[model samples]
Target: MIQLKHVLVLVFLCVFSGISQSTNGYELWMPYSNIEDSSLTKKYRDYSKSIYFPGSTETLMIAKNELHTGLRKMLGLASIPTNSNRLENTMIIGTKENLNSDIQQSLSKAYVEIGNEGFIIKTVSIKSKTVLVVTANTDIGILYGVYRLLNLMQQHKNLHNINAVDTPKIKLRMLNHWDNLDRTVERGYAGFSLWNWQKLPEFIDQRYIDYARANASVGINAVSLTNVNANALILTPMYLEKVEALARVFRPYGIKIYLTARFSAPIEIGNLETADPLDPKVQQWWVHKADEIYKLIPDFGGFLVKANSEGQPGPQNYGRNHVDGANMLAKALLPHKGNVIWRAFVYSEHDADDRAKQAYSEFVPYDGKFMENVLVQTKNGAIDFQPREPFHPMFGAMPKTPLMMEFQITQEYLGFSTHLVFLPKLFEEVLDADTFRKEENSTVAKVIDGSLHNQKLTGMAGVANIGTDLNWTGHPFAQANWYGFGRLAWDPYLSSETIADEWLRMTFSNDESFLEPMTRMLIKSRETVVNYMNPLGLHHIFDTGHHYGPGPWVSELSRPEWNPTYYHKADSQGIGFDRTPSGSNATEQYAKPLQELWNDPQTIPEEYLLWFHHLPWDYKLKNGATLWDGIALKYQQGVDEVAGMITTWSIMKPFVSKEQHEEVTMLLEIQLKEAKWWRDACLLYFQTFSKKDVPDGVSKPLYSLEYYKSLKFPFAPGIRPQWD
Candidate 1:
């Protein structure tokens, strides 16, 4: 962390400049600006005067070029190729296959060994002069090594003893971009889609380059570029050329592109009568589609499908199972070494039963029937991304199927782009959840990553929050969510607080004046949002359609599971949804311990109290407060915490970019106002059922429950129409 005085100096620079600017945060974690530390800058300047990549391979060239771009911006020098005369004190980057005779001799001397996605950076005496070697096992490893070196420079780490070696713990670290072809994101809050398909094959956006750079920096190797609610047109020849263009740009960064496949593409694009998986014509159509995709981009990462769910077409329309649908695509892509990622977020309006049990019921019986290349990507929770939810029942139940964990970094169900909610905590809470697969350490993380279940080809995906905004994500602080998602995807065991601290130091300054309170605010931010909006496991209470504000009274939606009132069973005598045996029996979906744990309200954690049971409004909580009072206090506390975040940010005005700081300042104010809006609207609405007072010191609502209910947001972003 940085000292207080250094932080003050940054504040002075911003204040004296008198520049008040607004930035839509589109740059994301790749803010490759100049370095601040003089000593480290000098060290890098001395060490990287020139650089070399040993191979002529395309991936190696990309690694070398990216190093040039990042180092040039950081050191204010145009990087050049190494000259034999300048070989000493220069950075040498290569794979073992392409190293020079002398460098190869040194590498064999046991000073360095490379892992698959790993590299070794070592200082050595060459011809009685100092030289640094960044050697790896493969071209992909060399690219990753470049990113690690850039990160070390960003954090101002010492290069003298920089012998760091690492590889991704998870095999498939990926991002699932919910970007539509028309530039409208599904749950995206950053800006419009970055693809810009209308101009894509003609005009490649520079943002795509930076996007690849950012993803590579975090060890993300795969990207799916369309919304899961896929369009059949994306499979057309025109879009294939656009996708191939993106793949060309990202290939150098070691990222393979993937596209969401519409299940009925054979019917829509191939002019086939039916897309039945069992039909020979439909199967031949898929094989032809796969062949076409490989022709344009041989290294394409295959398809992500959301068939038979949320009205998307799937084989279920023909009375086929998920395994039939998924295996058909897997067989098509298998010849190209590609895999299919089939989403398990299935729900039916026809089945008006408990939403939490629907996915497990649909997926569990078909576990061992899936093809080896098929991955059943399940959301962290059974319901949509709620503020807090227990581990999805499918985590441990599908031992025979490879289950990929999917998390929402876009905050669709949280508060959109306005609230300051750090999502790493939410991620950690889910990863640490135990599935009781014959041992205590059988965490959901292990299950998803194939450690506990011993399945091969593990995968995890983050729903991307990227857009066309200048700052990447709209909220400046929200950049941390993107950063955290990458870090955790690489190694799921990392604590949320640890990721936050690292992001704070790299993105802001290393000063304690900035890090201390700021870290505290980030660590508690997720819980604060939960307290205000969906405390005690009360889920999906946001407004209908766009889901912008409080909507505990929303009960008139078309489907039973579409309304907030469906999740939170708040009535005259009690509050909370009863998912226990007495209610929906959702607890029976888990293992014995979890079943016991969630079935009994007393043993269950207060964080998930309402998620599992319904209790009287006057029932005494574990904290010696009644259920109604406890819920009310949490709401008020969330409001206060957001206010505190604003004050904390105000105090660290010196250590941030003037443009960035002012943007965050305004966002925090927006958060504060909305936090109060959530607290007031929720308390006023829930009170109608509980008939409880606002507790002694809590302020009364500024507006009536009727007025809050009258609120509407027709213009809010991310709400798809029934037909869109």
Candidate 2:
């Protein structure tokens, strides 16, 4: 057996080796960076000289261990337990049930406000000395409380008068990993899946603990382990054991494990002749499978399904609609209180009609047809995850359907992992979009949490960007998107600017010298990427398959809908696909006021001008510039913003650690090059149809359109195999 000294050396070696490995961004928000704020360090040291956790439960144990580990790494000292006369100036942690009678009575008022999964941090004078008390209603609550206290210390906030009560607004806050069984993440750029399935159940990685800590710190309550485009093999006995191991690790952190269920699992797992949802044997198969999974993992969050979408098999294959399919699985999981999150991202290669209208048309009629445990998961937009898409038409359209908002934390459309695009602003745009259901502010948030529709069982899913990289999301700044997703998932009402400020304070430096410019850079980052990549409602312009770089000229895919040109419909007459009455009449899907507003380009927001209507090259924009000039200027503005981000990050070099500062500096350079690439490639291609000179003050394309079009990336990553 290895001695204690040997164990210490092994741990040191492992941590150092992990850090030295190439900067893939797998570390995420759990950087565990040594705390830098001098005043804050002293405050934490004074209040946490010793900790006495009264509870002796598994959750309380986890809370104590995590607090000890985090403090040692972050504050350079571990908490010592005290027994004799309550140690003054020390941190006290416990559930209400475990606290001493007198202490419990005093903390009762605070506990009432804390609620379940809520906590309170207060500095009280005990026998003429100040002691910080961290109390919660439950052990899991204390775990969250401990993390919250640490976060305050890390951010260098004054712990003198801390009183915060936070309860998640949504019932389910989750990360939906598009990670495959073989560990290849769909649309994932950082690296292979963080889950090493082959080594799991035998060897539990420390990374799993770190992942749990990162999530719990941000109040993310659940994680789906597999891709919605799932593998049936994940449900077999072999994989169940692997999943149980993960569940064991995550359980203490208040995160429940969920799996993606392949819709045709009956046929795939049970050697059944058919997977028709109504079939008795098929129903029995799912019931047994859910039972098997629950037996292995008691607190399992149910399945996330991607049925009848993009050629995935479903009950639709047997002529049954989504409601027919979802209800069947919902019934199977009802006994275990598990849910069925059926995705509404369905489209067809054969639909000559507008893609935006497909989901709304298929599901609106079946609004109240689902099971009580079923939730129809809808993406932010109707089409794929575009850089900028209007809110999906189904938001207020489904009054009876419990529609959960699905946002992508991964930057699949916004330049993958290389570009520094903060997505809170993007989320803010969609969340605040006036669905015009009944009133002016009938927002998407209201529809998602069952508030506007007056239903129950609220949920929200973010397609995860996590991978096996050191920094988590590839780019250091990209971690903000993940952080923002969880915060917004917890409270959808929080503004994008607010989330940016919090993330900047937590991830980077809290000094205003560093915060002001970095916050500005983050707030504008998403729009900068949008301007450079797909301006004026232009969508799906990236190359086919890999989806990297420009491919506006791509019109040779197997299906017309799969081609970039099919979405843009750019021609000599004008650019942009007209979804107006004269075109596909797709705007009819919106409610009265929006349908009217979007029907005319003159009334629409400038940010979404080209999305609704097709305009001539010289059409006058709201900004007093012609459409062509406006488009060119927007692209140039994007390139300039990226340049500004570079300058902003350079200013932060002194505030941030050299290791992190240098990594961001290098990534910004890559972003600048790619921003210009997007600009040149797009302008060169679009200039062909406009038959005009490059707009004044806008630099001419550095290369010929033919040269830009000739750029090929046959070896680009994230390409899904046709056979798979």
Give each model's whole-structure lDDT.
0.84, 0.83
Highest lDDT among the candidates is held by which one?
Answer: 1
lDDT of 1 by residue, 427-490 (tens): 9999999999758879999997788978878999999888887778877888899899888888
Alpha-carbon shift of residue 401 in model 2 (angstroms): 2.1
- Per-candidate TM-score against the hidden true structure: 0.93, 0.93
Task: Give a tens-digit lDDT track for model 2, residues 73-113.
Answer: 66766445555345443777777765568667877777776
Q: Cα deviation of 40 in candidate 2 (Å)?
A: 3.8
Candidate 1's displacement at residue 174, Å, is 2.0
TM-score of 1: 0.93
Counted clashes in each candidate structure? 14, 10
